[model samples]
Target: MKWSEFKIHTTNEAIEPVSNILHEAGASGVVIEDRNDLDKDWSTMYGTIYELDPENYPEEGVYIKAYLPVNSFLGETVEEIKQAINNLETFDIDIGHNKVTISEINEEEWATAWKKYYKPVKISDKITITPTWEDYQPVSSDEIIIELDPGMAFGTGTHPTTVLSLQALERYIQTGDSVMDVGSGSGVLSIGAILLGAADVQAFDLDEVAVKSTTINVKLNKVQDRVTTRQNDLLKDIDVQADVIVSNILAEIIVKTTQEAYQLIKPGGYFITSGIINAKKELVKQDLEKQGFNIVETNQMEDWISIIAQKPE
Candidate 1:
């Protein structure tokens, strides 16, 4: 399968609007990369995705992204994609060199394509998640099935940090506990709680794509009635206290969010947080400790850590 990869370089402020324009013009999807720029806003550098057409497609886009089609199912060629970027130079957006690799696969090797990447994943042994396109068996002990088409948005549970959070959720969630999943990308953590025995789950994230993606996953898992989503800044103006709180945002945000997260969890409740890098872990741990949370456990995976701290009993 031949595919075109497009890379665009421009000022931080223009990324979203330009990505939006490209989506409107027609794009299969966009992958936003965090290219280091001192002048760049870290907030804006987080990337997103969109869909484009292969049939009767407009090979050119005003805010062009490279496009190449894979022969596996459907998608465009690298050359056709390059032309689109070459055309966008007038807007002063520089196209990066292609590092995309394409390969041809046997047309009927459907299982092989995904099988190489898909493995039996237990969000917990009871709450096993399998991609919808893959084949898997749910043993009698398995509680629910979550279907997802994984992408860059987050919460596929492939990451150890997310897995850490899920394992903690499985351990702590009571049968009727209410949970608030802050930064609920793909709603994976919150939905996992609900499936694990939480009575009701409310989740929020800063990204619209995350909110939409989480909502979709909630529905896909048939837990829509149990899980609700909203878009809001971290615990600002939210007054209801829950039995458990989960946040998987950056360590800085997590550190700053302690006061608010503390307020959102009832005295007996606990908070689960990830997205903490090793370098910043102590800083956040100190901040969380000061908020009167007793650090119950810390689990490390790769360079990431998941911390669970309980508000005083």
Candidate 2:
């Protein structure tokens, strides 16, 4: 079988949304090659080894690559993806170079090759996300492991936005609390909440592919009973109250749901928002505050920011 390698040259700030566009367009797997990664100071605490090659990276902006099966509708899908990414600018997101290219490849080449880009990495104090194919064991008795098959989802759960969300969950999630995960890509945040001691989680995503991916990941993590996957726009017409509401999506989308999120969260509960670029941090912060939330913590990993806000008791 033949496959098309669709690649986009875009800024780091645009990575989350562009990758999301590709996934929604039916891409099999997404690979991000950022030039900045070569200069990252990886920690050896988790014994995770890095073997990066400079040749694979672009000199300026990041490269977002995805695999799509060569079919009759391939051209239309690519055009839709391009338009979707261009539409991101209305939300104030910089699309950077915005150059897109495509190449043909054999199925045998990419089926397993993308797996090499993922491995076990301790993203937070207690949680370590590893691909399903790797043989990884806990180095500490209290360490938590999350196994993800990125081929079936949008991300491997190692992105900075996700890491910040997991870290916030580790800090705020009570043992028996309920969590609502908006924009639950890969269901990573929902599964992470369950593993971190939340009794139950409600995972919602606007995309059907994301909904399916979340369901599969929930089962893979053996948290099926504790997590429920639903297809819904962010907090639209949702009435359930949760101890914590976490969303790792665009800041513009996050602001639109501030009122709904505030009403849905129980008093003293928290709203954790991520996938916010540095420039838009103030926008989310102001929106949350206007909705009566008290900013409890703000954290940054690289260029992304995660804001943790709480409802007053």
Candidate 3:
């Protein structure tokens, strides 16, 4: 079998959305090469060693690489991905150079090549996301480890948008509370909710692949009894109410569903949202407020923003 490695050269700000575009277009996990990682001071105490080549990294923007099987429709798929990324501009996202390149690689090589890019990352105080292939041990007794395999789905549970959402979840989720995870890609957030002591979680996504991925992840985490995965559009005609409502989707989609989020969340419930570009922060903030949600907390990482708001009692 043969695979095409699609590379997109763009700014760090565009990583989440562009990666999402590829995922929506049927690309599995992606390898993100960012020059910023080179400057980070990692503890040498960890047993595993990482050898990074400086030449492979770009001096400015990052490069995102995804693998797709070589097929007759490969060109059409790449074109659709390009158009989807271009659509991000209407939301005021900075796409940087927007250069795209492609190369061919053997399926056997691609199968194990992407593993090097994923490692155990502590995204929040209590949560550490470790890919299924990596062996990670918690440094503390209270640490929570999420075993994940992004597979052909988006959201590895390491993106800043995901980190922000989980951080907010850790802070707001109460034991025995009900959680509603909108756009539940990879089921990472839903799994986090259950691990955080939420008694029940209802996960919804418009994409069938995402829905399937979430179901598998929920079972992988051994929380199948606590989670229910379904396919549904964003907060559309859903009568289920939950104590906490969270959605880590595009800023525009977040704004579009603010009213429904507010309506579905019980009085005094919390609504946590991420996948927002810094430039569109105020726009989402304003919409959430207009929908009668009281802003509670705001978190920013690099160029992304997560806003948490509470419905008044």
Candidate 4:
């Protein structure tokens, strides 16, 4: 089989939303090449190894690459992806150059080439994300290991937004508390919640692939019985209330669902949200506050932001 690789050049602020747009356009996975990553001090024993090729990286901004099978509708899919990316500017997101390129490759290369980019990453104080193909050992007695194989899915549980969300989960999850995971990609948060002693988790995603990926990942961590997966738009018509509600999606979606999230969480429960770029933090913060949630914590890593808010009892 043949596959088309679409490489999009855009600003750092546009990477997350553009990648999401590509995913929604039927791309299984995406590769991000941020020029800033080349400047990071990565030799400080961060417990994560990244093997990046300088040739493929952008000279400015970032490059996001995704693969789609060579089919009759391939051209239409690519055009739609471009249009969706252009729509980001309406949200005041800087898209930079927004240059797009395409190339064809064999399916075999697509299957194995991406593995080299993933490694054992210690994302937070107690949680470490390891790919299924890697041989990893627990370096600490209390360390929590999340084993995941994104397969054709987009998340590997190591993105800054994901890391911040997991770290927040670590700090707030209580033993036997119920968790509601909105946009639970790869089921990483649900698995993390269960590991952190949450009694049960209801995970939802609008994407069918994400729902399936979450189900498989929950079972991979041996928490299928504790975590339930389903396809649902964020917090619409959901009657079940949870001890804690978490979402790691775009700031636009997060803000739109803030009120519903507030209604779905138990009194005094917490709402943790990420996938917010640095510039949009204040907007989301104000939205959550307007919905009667008291902002408790704000976390930032790189260009991303995460907020933890509590519903007043």
Who wins the TM-score comparison? 2
lDDT by residue (42-154, candidate 4, tens digit) is 76635645866789788898988888899999999988888999989998889999999999999988887567777898888899999888889999899999999877455
lDDT by residue for model 2 (1-313), tens: 9999999999988988888888888888899888887877786443454599999999987999999999999999988998999999997889999999999999888797688899899987899998888899998999999989888687888878998999999999999999999999899999999999999999999999899999988888899999999999999989889999999998889999999999999999999999999999999999999999999999998889999999999
Better of 1 and 4 by lDDT: 4
Question: Which candidate would rank higher by lDDT, 2 or 3?
Answer: 2
Off by over 4 Å in 1: 1-3, 6-116
User: Model 1, 198-217: lDDT tens per residue?
Assistant: 99998987767668778888
Prediction 1 global C-alpha lDDT? 0.64
Relative to the true structure, candidate 4 reaches a TM of 0.94
lDDT of each: 0.64, 0.91, 0.87, 0.88
Which whole-number lDDT from 0 to 100 does residue 47 have in model 3? Answer: 27
lDDT (Cα, tens digit) per residue for candidate 3, span 159-181:
77888999999999999999999
Better of 2 and 4 by TM-score: 2
Please report, as a residue range, the 10-residue window in candidate 3 with the lowest summed lDDT. Answer: 40-49
lDDT of 2 at 160: 82
- TM-score against truth, every candidate: 0.66, 0.97, 0.92, 0.94
What's the CA error at residue 16 for candidate 2, in Å?
Answer: 1.7
Model 2 pairs whose backbones collide: none
Off by over 4 Å in 4: 43-45
TM-score-superior candidate, 3 or 4: 4
